[model samples]
Target: MKLWGGRFLSKESKLMEDFNSSLSFDKKLYYEDIIGSIAHVKMLAKCNILTNEESKTIVNGLNSIMSDIKEGKLKIEGDYEDIHSFMEINLIKTVGEVGKKLHTARSRNDQVAVDMRLYSKYKALDVIDNLDIILGTIKILGNENAVIMPGYTHMQRAQVVTFKQHIMAYYSMLSRDKKRLTSAIEIMDENPLGCCALAGTTYDTDREFTTKELEFKKPVDNFMDGVSDRDYLLELLSAFSIIMMHFSRLSEELILWSTKEFNFIEISDEFSTGSSIMPQKRNPDAAELIRGKTGRVYGDLMSLLTTMKGIPLAYNKDMQEDKEPFFDAVDTVLKCIKIMNEMLGTLKIKKDNMHNAVKRGFLNATEAADYLVNKGMAFRDAHSVIGNIVITCEKKNKAIEELNLDELKSFSDLFEEDVYEFIDYENTISRGIKKEM
Candidate 1:
């Protein structure tokens, strides 16, 4: 099963083989490996490198391997060097000697590069699909529950905003995340199959034929870059990191809102958990875990950056370090998206509590200043007057709205019966949204 044993007289030690083998994780690339191999085989035959009958025989063996592996007839695990070895080794064993020709113009370097690109290309699309689902769920929440709430600055109520505006902030972040992934896919869409180890082949290989057969956008122009470039992965990891950061922000708010003090929303019982000692616990474990996993995804990105930073040209064993972290990030973000979407769908929005919080926190304080400005008071003077009014209201244990006209006029002559309408939460949010238009 060792692919490079011609020059080696001594058998490889078990420990070294174990250390060097990537089949443990890269077996995840089995389907990609076989599919790329099929494309390469067909290209080889089309270019007359293999007889038509020989190409069919190798392809048949490759197809049989896929069926047997899927059906559990073949267990694709052992002391093989990697999935490429396991595959070509099995292909030869299955279809006799013709199976050896399947790798006629390919190198494991290009083979693995193509496999990883193929894997990332499709998985990125899956992540986008999940993002779309999450976006749809959030749009529904923002539309159905249009209640006004106190928007925060530095964790303190700063202004009036609707629950819709708050949730849609995440929608914006995830939408950009989807686009980042799409762009990364486009950048890595060139077919790298014929690059072959880095130097390419002397044989008259038709890379364009394989490119079209494999459904890539085009063939890679540089043999060295095709096998060596992992910029696509770094771009994708960066996108996934941004996504987790957005998830973490939303998760922090969800955890805070589910608490007794906030009482703004309730996570469903299915996503909740119990404490071992406290019988009254219904923890927002789903949101909490999502927040924690954000760090893990960040680490996945950093891990690859460190791994790829020092490695030099063409191909290196160091590149094998890339797959696990990349796969981990993909799995983490997908799970986070799925759970968050479900959690958002079943949430119980506490509109009354949200409204009460808005009122209690002087969310309309900014509106009071704007109200004075409308009455022709200088904005600076209105701001100072509102500051004093807030202090007095806090000392009196009263909201700004609770003060009567004479009490409000003591601070400023701009106060009137219409002040109530101007600072109403609904009117405040409406005016706030209108300013954007």
Candidate 2:
């Protein structure tokens, strides 16, 4: 069953076989491996490396194996070195001697390169699809919850903003994330099937035919780089890390808003969990878990970066370390995206609580400054007058809007009846900066 057995006189020790085996994790790549092999065998026949009949038999065998694997009729297991070895062994078992010809003009080096590229492309699209769902949910939230809320700076209420504007901020962040994933997919579109080991093969293999069969943009230009390039994986992991980071920020806000202290929003019971000891606890476990998993995705990215940083040109055993990290990141990000969409879609907004919260904070002090500036006070002088008014209001335990016109005029004769309109919570949002679509 071993492809390289002809060169070795003795069987590899059981311990060494166990140490070298990757069938456990890499078997997940069976579908991609079969796809690339089908294309490779067809190209082999076109190049006259295999008879047409032999190519047909091998392709049929591969297709049967793929269907069996999908249907759970066949199981991929045992001491196979990798997915490539496991597949070649199974193909030989199915098609007899003709299956040996399937690997005649290729190597595991290029085979894995093509499989990973295909897998990454599929997962990137999955990420983008989930992002579309999240974007749609955000748009719904924005349209329904356009009421005013207090926006924060340094975790303290600093200005007035509409809920729609806050949600759209995340929409903008995720829009950029979608672009990054698309760029990563574009970078991985080339075929790496015919590079064979670290150099071009002497056999007359038709790389262009296989490239077209696999739907790659083109065959890779350099044999060594084809065997060695993993920048696409790195690029994707980087993009996934950033996507998770954005999700983590949103998760933090969700956790905060769901708290009794904030009471700004209420997560649906399905997405929340009760504390074991407390009768009155409904914790935001989903949001907390998404925030926690952000670090795991970050670790996956860093693990691959460190592994690839020291490896030399062309394929190396170190590159075998690439798959687990990449797979973990993809799975983690996709799950987080889906759960976040569900959590957000079902959550309830507390518009009254948000409005009352706005009243307590001196969120209108800036508008008061603008009121003074409109009365012909210098900008810096207006700022100072507002600051002094805020201090006096705090001493009397009142908001700037609570001060009467004669009391506000003690600081400056510029105070007017229209000053109340300038600091009104609803008016502040209407007068503040607006974002262009």
Candidate 3:
């Protein structure tokens, strides 16, 4: 029988039961549900709603159920409507009539609210921990590969940069992602356990007590908002999407770097795959998959955003649609971060190839223009002189630096032996341009 089936004389069809049941996915919240219930029962006993002995019995039964589930002794199966019902049915069987009192002043509405908040809180922290690992890996790579490389804009080589600077640029982006995730965790720290359905309960319940017990910062201010709010979930999904965006950008570079045409870096065999027919094929499948998974995470955020946009105040069944998307995004981002860290940590940097590529791209053209400007040439005239010099170099099949000093002086009297220093790749990086910019 359904927990709230007291008024209905007819039984629910199997189709309705299957359609309405959330135990399939919500079983994942078994630990969270039990933790929230234990806190609530403790608060009830503190308020004199349940006798001390009755509360003890309920708490012990809940703990036993938790232990059994953790030990793989209790299988979360059968036709219970949701996790709350599954726990309640088992609690009753474990402790008899006293177990029923555990739900005296609460509803599944507030119960689910607290469970989800707890789940989000912990998962957000877990994501931050993984991000810290990624950040550390990036810092190590940045320090190790501080050699000069060509930086590009619009897929055309535009300037010279240190690989260290390039790697740390991603580090800055992930630093912001960490801050955003931490803020999301703070936003979800309120307890919703004592709010009951959509309003304050008539019982003399101590919400503050439950908040303290459950380690939430405070109880939510409004009961209706407490029951209906999914902003925390949305905020978390937004964070996840942004993090994936950063990952996708890095993955794009990794893909390009691993290609033979670029040959900037070599992915390790452990993180790469081989083609069946192509004897020389070694693919950066990990990076490619991380890039691909980014779209699915974005879709998850959009799915939840669209679901919540039209819902009314207070809890509704539509809110049930929020879980799968949030869960999938969280799982996807965590896995991506783990794999990305491994791929980055194991990859080989071809320092000579990177420096050689920088030489081929005329990345020092801007510095040549700057050199003329420093010699009292007007900035526009300096740019024009460098443009003509580049055309001449291309005609001769020579680099600007490869030109004789007399040939350079022919372009402008401002050219001097120091022009060679100005075009040096390492000197370009040492010119005080900020890495993050």
In candidate 2, stretches whose alpha carbon ends up further than 4 angstroms from where it belongs are 433-437
lDDT of 1: 0.92
Question: What does candidate 2's lDDT look like per residue over 1-437, in tens digits?
Answer: 68888989999998988888888988889999999999998888888888899999999999999999999998898768998988888889998987888888799999999999999999999999999999999999989998788899999889888888899899999999999999888878999998999987999888889889988889899999999979999999999999999999999998998888999899999899998899899989999999999999999999999998988887998898999999999999999999999999998999988878888779888888988888899989999998998889889999998999899999999998999987898877876644344
TM-score versus the correct structure, for each prediction: 0.98, 0.97, 0.98
* lDDT digits (tens) for residues 63-95 of candidate 3: 999999999999999979999999999999999
Arrange candidates, best TM-score first: 1, 3, 2
lDDT of 3 at 370: 92
Poorly placed runs, candidate 1 (over 4 Å): none
Instruction: For candidate 1, write residues 1-437 as lDDT tens digits.
Output: 67789899999998998899889899999999999999998888899999999999999999999999999999989878999999999998999988878888889999999999999998999999999999999999999988988899999999989899999889888998989988889988999888999999999999889899889999899999999878899999999999999999999999999999999999999999999999999999999999999999999999999988988897888989999999999999999999999999999999999877887888899889999999999999999999999999999999999999999999998799999999988888887789854
* Local distance difference test scores for all models: 0.92, 0.91, 0.92
The runs of at least 3 residues in candidate 3 whose Cα sits more than 4 Å from the true structure, single-residue gaps closed, are 433-437
Report the C-alpha displacement of residue 383, candidate 2, in angstroms.
1.4
- Which model is ahead, 1 or 2, in terms of TM-score? 1
